[model samples]
Target: MRLMPRSLFGRLLAVATLATLAALLLASVAIGHVLERFVMRGFDDRLDAQTMVLARAVDARGRFDTTRAIDLPGFDEAGSGWIWQVRSADGQVWRNGAEALPVPASRADAPPPPPPGMASERARDRDRSHPGEGRDRTGQRQHFRTLTLMRVGGPVAITASGPRRVVEAPLREAMLPLLGSLALLGIGLAAATLVQLRIGLRPLRTLQAALGNVIAGRQHHVPTDLPVELAPLAHELNTLIDQNAEGLAHARRHVANLAHGLKTPLAGLGLELADRDPDGRLAAMLADIDRRVSHHLRRARAAMPGAPGRGAIPLAPAIGDLVDVLRRVHADRPIAVDVAVDGVTVGVDAQDLDEMLGNLLDNAWRYAATAIGIAAVVDAGKAVITIDDDGPGLDANQRAEALVPGRRLDEAGPGHGFGLPITQELAELNGGGLVLGSSPTLGGLRATLTLPL
Candidate 1:
């Protein structure tokens, strides 16, 4: 149902090819007509010359003198398709070849002969020289291109004719080369059109590459030095990017201001309740409020756009630093840490990476019995990092509940249930995700983090 192509290049090429073929066809028709006329005119001129020679043999009294005419090739031979005849008003006829020329039904019906000394003038008019059908001595019909000339003062009409092939054979021969040259010309035009399309569309490909760089955070704006036709589009795209970044920054400033205002009062309330509250019920409530405020503040910072044109950060060094700090914090407990991350990188900010990994590693260290395993690999264009502990792991339902914000499954731990939720939010903001499952190797909780490469 689709007659046209979906791509711009395909559509342009199709139109060019059709136009070239049509122009070549029209040229062939025009050239063939002109060449046919040239060949036919030359054939008729030769016949007219032979007619003049035969006319000189006729006398003024309607008599044709046989000896006065010069002998020409194919004229005097038997069965030759070339023939000349002079017919007088008294019914006396003279011919050079053995075949008799077919006579008209009436002398009055014949076309008027050319006037004396005007044979060359008459040759210019194609209506005067025409083709006729005649019979040979064997009674077979033959086609001939004939010309008739008459004496000015006598009733004698002289005619000379040759086979129609004299006009047609040369045209056929000339056509072979003409057709070949036109074919070559068409091929050349098609090749030229292809090259022109590629060169003309190169700017579009460049524009696409520039847009991709912006999306990958490798550039802040598209290049403006483009063709006149595409300059407006690139300018509009850069304007839109600036608008979005400004809006995100304004929202982040508002969130930071609100979090700071709440933290001051919450800190003052915690100190006031230290002596008045012995059960510590009000103190726990104040601590929960502080944790929520800090969670939102960190989330707002994570949601802010990253530095323009930022590059990927190496994962191994960040992991090593976090593990060393966690070991120092939990130095009283005996734990074994195995790290296998090397030569791997992730397209997330260094601070966000440290926060996400620090949360997961701290949890692993807290719940780990004696050993913890940390490894990373690239999978399907993403970096996958797994941290496993060799302690009691939660079931499927418990694992799902642990990711919920402010929902703590274990009361014995010293957390307000904000760590895993904060980690998951930061991972998602940087185009990554976190999932918790049972570790097949350590037989404990496995925290898998995936981030763009």
Candidate 2:
């Protein structure tokens, strides 16, 4: 128990365990005090009994007729601090010349001492014997008690006093076993606390394993045998995976339908135009159909942005990779790219962002004249990526039309009228947009894509 517990269960159980230890320690100390008083009082009772036994020995003669010195009971001043004194009827003392006892106070309504055979009395010690009669009280005394008895002559008082060090000696020897057992219990409690923490955290580890399986594309749903507190999170993850599968299947079906619908019509019209005005009109329509087909195909390639598997892709590294790949493709032209983006990371589907930037960089390489420059900067509230090339720029009207399907800046290629439109659609997919602007560095067409932070 320091400021912080080492583990979760340790912190929880330490509160109860430490509290119980403190309460038990307090009770033990209190009981130890009471027991010390009781043991000292038991010793005083013996002294009272001895004084009465000597008083009964006297007859009507009132004579000191003890047989031997060793016959006196409790008269040995040996262990247990035992002592005794015997007095006669006229305040005269006998047997073991002893010090005067420190007399005690009594209640006004207290009963007087009875006859010698059944006599008993108790009292607390008073200050002194009439001001100055050789008093002695030191030695850091533990417990003190006084006893009085009545006889045929005068009252005889018996008193007992000792330092607590004598009683504490035996008590400490007895408490050793109990304290050792409690120490062992404290150690056992610590071990139990660690075991409890491991058992309690098992559910979290199982949930993580289920997520790992889903990420590796092994299963669509997680098992339901989870703890009650963690069941909601498991249910939500399973439902999300199911929804993503259904949506992707539907999108694939849509792409197939579009491809089939356009392919059949273009083939039929091409055969009929073989005998009429066959001046590439059927070919142009076929090309437009192909462009439209490719546009929908790229849509299927874009990521499902709602899925949770997308990790943070560093914008700078992604841009650099795309630029390097395009550089090898356009090695014939000395196209130079200047990158100035920093450590800004954006939340994007990894494959989707790669495809978007790849297409944009390829487009710039194809149309650039002397130099193609790539610049990325945070502008206003978005990631503004400007790909500029020093080539013949598009006019205002063509710039607007080039972003749509079946439109291109230069009208000559295998898969024509589809690159810019596909790039535009991808830009808007992940909460971003594509813009047609004049390049500040190259004085040509600049494809500016703004992704919100």
Candidate 3:
């Protein structure tokens, strides 16, 4: 379908190379034409000189002196394909040597005098294959260039002729090296253009890589160390990133304030209901309302959309803090919390990361028999943190239901089953995910969290 390339590099290279080739082609043609013209002019000069010599050597008595030392070697040699002819008023034509060429018929007894210099006088014959020159060395019919000069005193004309191929032979020989040089020049120009394109576009490539780092949460903003032409673009992108971060932060704060402000009102309403309704007829309704309010409040506190361009926070310290707090809370249970996390970073807000791990670790401590194992590492450009506990782990169905909000497996349990669901939500908000499976090493339920590296 499309003949041209789509990339900027391809299109630019193609256009530059084509332009270079066209320029070289035009220069070659112009130079070649000029060379051929110059050669033809030189041929005409020789014919003019010979005609002048012949006209001066002859006398007004219409007699050529053979004893005179005329240095016209071409005319002196028979069958040389270079000849001279003289015409007089009596319709008589005298040729110096005519072993190979015919004497052309005269149109009139006496011809008009030629111009002062040797002039281009067209002969009656138009064919290029002269009888004097049947064919040249290449077997092509040899053409001739003739010049005529007339003496002013008497009705006399002198014409000198030379082969046309002499003028063109030198031009043909000169073209080979000329065209080779131009071809080499075109190649050199193409290479230079490629280097120029790479150097010119390097700034754009750097900008693209910097943007990718920002998007992946590895850097805070585009680097300002760019060319003058691209510096404005980097500044604009940094401004936009700052604007988006401000907007998200404002929205989160508003939600948190709203949730906290509603808590007192909900509590007062519950007190008023308890004082008014003594029969507990609305007990279930009040419980549901309280649960919904608490859930909304919890979500408001935990809703962190992970900061843009934040480097991954270290995982070992966060996991250790959560494990230490949980161990103290369940000290009487004799639970051993083993933490193996080291040098791993998670791309999430520090508070949100703590909340997610705290929920998982606390839930594990509740059901663990004796031990809990926590480890984290980087895998496939993601931070994978796994927590395993030797507890009465949930089966497949229960694991699936545990992520549902407020879905508790045991109605008589010590705590509400909102931990896993809250952790899942926090993970999702921070561009991470949570998965639950049986722990192969700990012989209990395993929780795996995957987040951006």
lDDT of 2 by residue, 171-246 (tens): 7775677567666776676677667767888888788788877764456688778888888888988889889878
Model 1 agreement with the true structure over 1-453: per-residue lDDT tens digits: 999999999999999999999999999999999998898677667776677677677775657788898757767676667788777767778787566775443454355655556666545542344455554555544444444434444446666766666667788888889999999999999999999999988889988998888766579899989989989998998999889778867877898889988998888888888999999898988887897788667657665567253358998889999988988999988799999989998977666788799999999999999999999999978899999999899999999999999999989979899889989987876767999999999999999998888
Off by over 4 Å in 2: 1-10, 13-75, 78-81, 85-136, 150-156, 215-218, 227-453
Model 3: lDDT of residue 363:
83
Residue-level lDDT of model 3, residues 272-314, one tens digit each, is 8887788887766777767666655555555455523545688
Model 1 spans > 4 angstroms off: 58-65, 69-71, 74-80, 86-94, 100-128, 131-159, 257-376, 379-450
Displacement of the residue 445 alpha carbon in candidate 3, Å: 26
Give the candidate number with the greatest TM-score. 1
Give all TM-scores, in the order shown.
0.61, 0.47, 0.57
Query: How close to the true structure is residue 210 of candidate 3, measured as C-alpha lDDT?
Result: 91
TM-score of 3: 0.57
Sort by lDDT, best first: what order?
1, 3, 2
Which predicted model would earn the best lDDT?
1
lDDT (0 to 1) per candidate: 0.80, 0.63, 0.72
Ranking by TM-score: 1, 3, 2
